[model samples]
Target: MEFDKNFKTHSFRATFITDLLKEVPIHIAKDIVGHEVVSSTEIYYRSSLTKKDSLKILNSVDTLRFN
Candidate 1:
């Protein structure tokens, strides 16, 4: 597939880190990227998530079952 002209190598890094944040802890992602602060990593991290993404996450939560 042809990539958008604006896409760059750093874009791949951002995408990779963003996907990692979805499945893993933020601290883990911070260490992986060697960021001095989680907030620094968060700048890239937060932008990746969308409203639909938030809904998907919320929907994935299993409702409490009464025993």
Candidate 2:
């Protein structure tokens, strides 16, 4: 709730944006942050990776395969 004034904004912003986009829907995040609309959240956040990036990681894991 409370953060020091000298705390690194870039690190905090990166963590906040990553968690916002990669974990939950924009609307839900907007609500959590008291934004009136999902677009407000989207304007400030973006994903570092696409769905294809996630699929590539999943494919590379090789923990399971269809027989």
List, residue by residue over 1-67, the lDDT tens digit for candidate 1.
9988998987777888889898889999999889989988877753657899878777666343322
- TM-score, per-candidate, Cα-based: 0.58, 0.48
Best by lDDT: 1
- TM-score top scorer: 1
Q: Tens digits of per-residue lDDT for model 2 on 29-62?
A: 8887777987667766746778999899888776
Clashes (backbone N, CA, C under 3 Å), per candidate, total: 0, 0
Candidate 1 lDDT (Cα, 0 to 1): 0.80
Q: After aligning candidate 1 to the native by TM-score, how far in Å is the CA of 35 from where it should be?
A: 0.6
Determine which window of 10 residues in candidate 1 has minimal summed lDDT: 58-67
Candidate 2 has a TM-score of: 0.48
Q: Note each model's CA RMSD in angstroms.
A: 4.5, 6.6
